[model samples]
Target chain A: MSEEHKHTNYMRIFWILLTLTIVEVGMAYTMQSHKALLIVALVTLAFIKAGMVAAYFMHLKLERKTFIAIVCFPLILAVVLVIGLFPDVGFKLGGKHHHKPAASQDSGHAVEHK
Target chain B: MSSVALAAHPPSQEKEILGVSSGKMAMWLFLGSDGMSFMGLIAAYVALRIGNWGIWPDPTKVLAIDLTAINTFILICSSVTMVKAFAASQEGNVGKLKQWLFFTMLGGAIFLGVQVYEYSQLIHHGVKLWDSAGRPAAEWLHPAIQGHSTLFTATFYACTCFHGFHVLSGVVYLAFILIGVMRGRWTVNRIEIVGLYWHFVDLVWIVIFTIIYLF
Candidate 1:
């Protein structure tokens, strides 16, 4: 790519990212009450911004298919990790409702670092 | 001459992956694993916050957004400069490469400085790493801690500080690259490799900013 062309592309991406951020912040304030919708919008916009950076600024778009595959292959594990953790953390697994009151007070005992 | 010709025409199929360098491959793998670690942290954060639900203090009430918004813009701008530096290096324009790399480093430094300021502010506002019990503690903590969870301070500190460390290291990385470029020891390949790391830092910040500050 020519220097001039690369410059234009980078600048364009910067503007787009800036605009998206502004929109995200704006939505954060305006949509404070609509909790579910706000979360969806915020997360979706964040991902779009991430994709733009990865594809253009990082030049992943210019890379070959093999290179893209090599880089993306590990993300499968990441997705699985997030999914597997959601049930335990976010949802009540196995439908057995266990009311554990000590869980909150046990915060002090949490996260013992070696 | 016949042996030389035979050697030259030895391979018809592909032997080397086109345009993919070892440095890039390594960086990508590093970023991939680093990303997973970050994902784990974020997922844990989401789980903890959502599980607690209503007892947590509103993040906006406890945190400053205007300053962080500026910091986020600085990082985005730095990513642009980093990309520009890589382009200049590819063109073999040493002067532009050095200039943009320095600017990129400057941006990273400013971002770190702002983060330090934010951390100090949070600390002053009574955000502590943990109490004597190792649990997260904070001054602005809601009073309804009867049974719900309250680990906001811990999660916020862990996530932001990890990202701040990355920014600090990126600044150091760029500084070294700047010195090497001045001494003519670094090439376009080196800049490209470091650029991958720099951009990855910026990318992670985008996610962190959204999750921690925005929502």
Candidate 2:
């Protein structure tokens, strides 16, 4: 195995997670008003964390295709299930009036002029 | 060469039944079903909380993120150690595998320990799983405060504490595997199977970290 490559990846992931976590704290403290930005930031950071773990720690970069496929398929199915449950998940999270309606609804980002 | 060409072909259809081991397969299925179970709880919360016309809690405002963030690091570290254990086994270094397994177990224990501490802090902060200072949820501090509902705390404790229980089981699993290694019952394949379970546990935590703590 390429030891240096693994080391560099680990270090990079460490720095990225640290930076993102710091940003999370900063945003939490700084951002005010129930705006869309905070949610976007949190989710983006989450996906980044997931990416790093999958690539490095899980060795997805080096994993066999069959195993990777097995893992990925289930995760995809899961995301779909969660997405399908958006109405329920949305309410559980906070509510429509809690914010995001003006940004998410009809004639909003859900459907575009283009 | 004729021999080399023949080796590339698939094994004949009439062969022994072999695929993912039943135990490992069962574990994966269990994890998958558990994931759905959690998604259902969370989804129900989201749905009902929304329907409540803004009665639920603001997750970020109330959760002790710093403690949980450290918990995240601890769990992720365990995942790294687990893979290391698998790697050691692959390299035929049983001693290294045992050491890594011990560290992996240590990491898991630290996570559970931290979680217990966090729970204590929350309870002290006037939020118990079944009661918010002995008043109805709507009567407590603002629902937007994140721990408003007895329901909220109930789900929180149930979800995370259940996850912790799995981590504990994994600790025992590692112990069995370690003892097996000492008795030379382990093959590289066994390491892979255990590593797969460990990895799945870590994966579940990753999602839990996002939903429970961050999102």
Candidate 3:
């Protein structure tokens, strides 16, 4: 009985992943007009896929409920650091700034590189 | 009295080297650390992207969707086979274990093959790394692709290539365990640990497939 339950859960996980991938593809289609909405959809799909893998594929569900929290909390911290560091590192390294339009910024940076 | 009793009794579960099975729990902890590494990479992607939208590439156009979806399906199937291998090993069914492991290995190989082909195809179409110079993919000629495409290619290479590396390591890891099966060293507990790592790799790809390929 317990064995059968595991198999059924596995099937459910497969379907859930399939559905999430489809949503991700669908969102990609709307990139031209609804950029914000598409970004939201992409993030949502990525989160769902991440959740499924951790819970099902990684056996976090089978191991212990606490494992999920332990794994996720540190990841969230790493994300915070990445976001915090980007403005300083990325903009400083490039001779260009993201705030300005590419059209206006390109003339100097382009000539220098070429 | 001491040596004979210790040999006969075997330590209790709690009294083992670790409070839990040392190796299995250790692998889980290692994965926890690995999870952080990937998170850092993803965070780098988001930051660079938001900060430099002008130069980042459109992922949808540069990446071929259909082929990657197929690769995703292959990975999902491999996860299924991995679970079955664990089940078979528990029941002492050597034949089933070998069959499932074989399928899992084949799936990993196919994933790697497709990735190599994809890289070549991208390069052929002018998506060279280390400098998109002299490639049809990047130049000062077209401005739209410059910010986005370059960003897209860099992120694409970093994410997928890292994921692909994990897949390759997994293949080697699984092969070593398969060798154990032939030699009767493989056991249910051992396969479970291998399965843990295998599943973590699969999980990493799941996120990559959604973020990098589909959306």
Candidate 4:
């Protein structure tokens, strides 16, 4: 009985993953107009697919909460790392006023390389 | 202890680090720490990209997304086969275990093959590393990619090549395990450990595909 149950579950998960991939690819073209929306949608779908792989294929879903915590703890640090970069990632924030466009400084830096 | 005594006194579930075998627990810990490495690469990529803002290459034109989607599907199938291999091993069905293990390895090989082909195509299109001379003077280059070839190519190679290296190692590891199975030296537990690694590779690819390709 357990064998049959696992077989069905694996099959189901595979189909779901395949469908999600198709949908994500399809959205790649159709969602071009709304860039922000497309990124959010793509990331959400990818996370769902990743969740399926981890929970079923890796058998994390059947594992104990402690295992899940072990898996998730590093991810929290990862998130914090990304978040830490955001303040200086693209926009101008308070600093030493040394932020200049790479193009504008090309002449000065180009001489050093030469 | 006799086999009977050992069998009767399996490692205490409560004391075995959340009931998982130490080996499995160690694998999970390694994956956790390794996950941070990938996160670092991806975060660096994203930061550089956001810094560049609108000038970053449009991956749809520069990358072979359709081909990679097919590759992603192949990897997903491989993950499925890996799970099936584990199930067969647990059932003590050596034949199915060998079959599924071979299929999983084949999937990894195909993925690596496709990646090599894609890299060759990109190189022909003038995508390369360490050449700060910018995009090749080739007329075939995508207009969006022409000015930004260095950053795009460098990050692309860094992120994907690292993942590709993982896939290569995975295929090699799977082959070793398959040989063990053939020689009747491997147990179901060993296969499960390798499967854990394989599944984690697939999981990382999921994030890479979204961030690098689709986004």
lDDT of each: 0.80, 0.66, 0.74, 0.84
Error of 2 at A112 (Å): 22
- Chain B superposition TM-score per model: 0.84, 0.79, 0.85, 0.89
Using DockQ as the measure, the top candidate is 4
Alpha-carbon shift of residue B75 in model 2 (angstroms):
1.2
The total of clashing pairs for model 2 equals 7
Of 1 and 3, which scores higher on DockQ? 1
Model 1 chain B poorest 10 in a row by lDDT: B139-148
Off by over 4 Å in 2: A1-15, A32-35, A63-67, A88-114, B1-31, B49-53, B131-149
lDDT of 1 by residue, A1-114 (tens): 366876788999999999999998888888889989998999899889988999998889889988888777766786787666654655542232345444533332232111
Task: Give the residue spans of candidate 4 off by over 4 A.
Answer: A93-114, B1-3, B7-15, B130-142
Clashes of each: 0, 7, 7, 0
Q: Is 2 or 3 the stronger prediction by TM-score?
A: 3
Worst 10 residues of 3 chain B by lDDT: B11-20
Candidate 2 local lDDT, residue B78 = 80
DockQ of each: 0.50, 0.24, 0.32, 0.54
- The residue pairs found clashing in candidate 2 are A88-B47, A91-B46, A91-B50, A92-B45, A92-B46, A92-B47, A93-B46
If scored against the real structure, what TM-score would every candidate get?
0.84, 0.73, 0.81, 0.88
Give the clashing pairs for model 1: none
Residue lDDT tens for model 2, A3-112: 55665566567667667766766676566464468767766777677766666765666756775576567667766766665554443333243344455544333532
Q: Alpha carbon lDDT of residue B40, candidate 1?
A: 80
The worst-scoring run of ten residues by lDDT in candidate 2 chain A lies at A105-114
Choose the strongest candidate by lDDT.
4
lDDT tens per residue, model 4, B24-115? 88888998888899999988888878777667888887888999999999999999999999999989999999999999999999999999
* Top-TM-score candidate index: 4
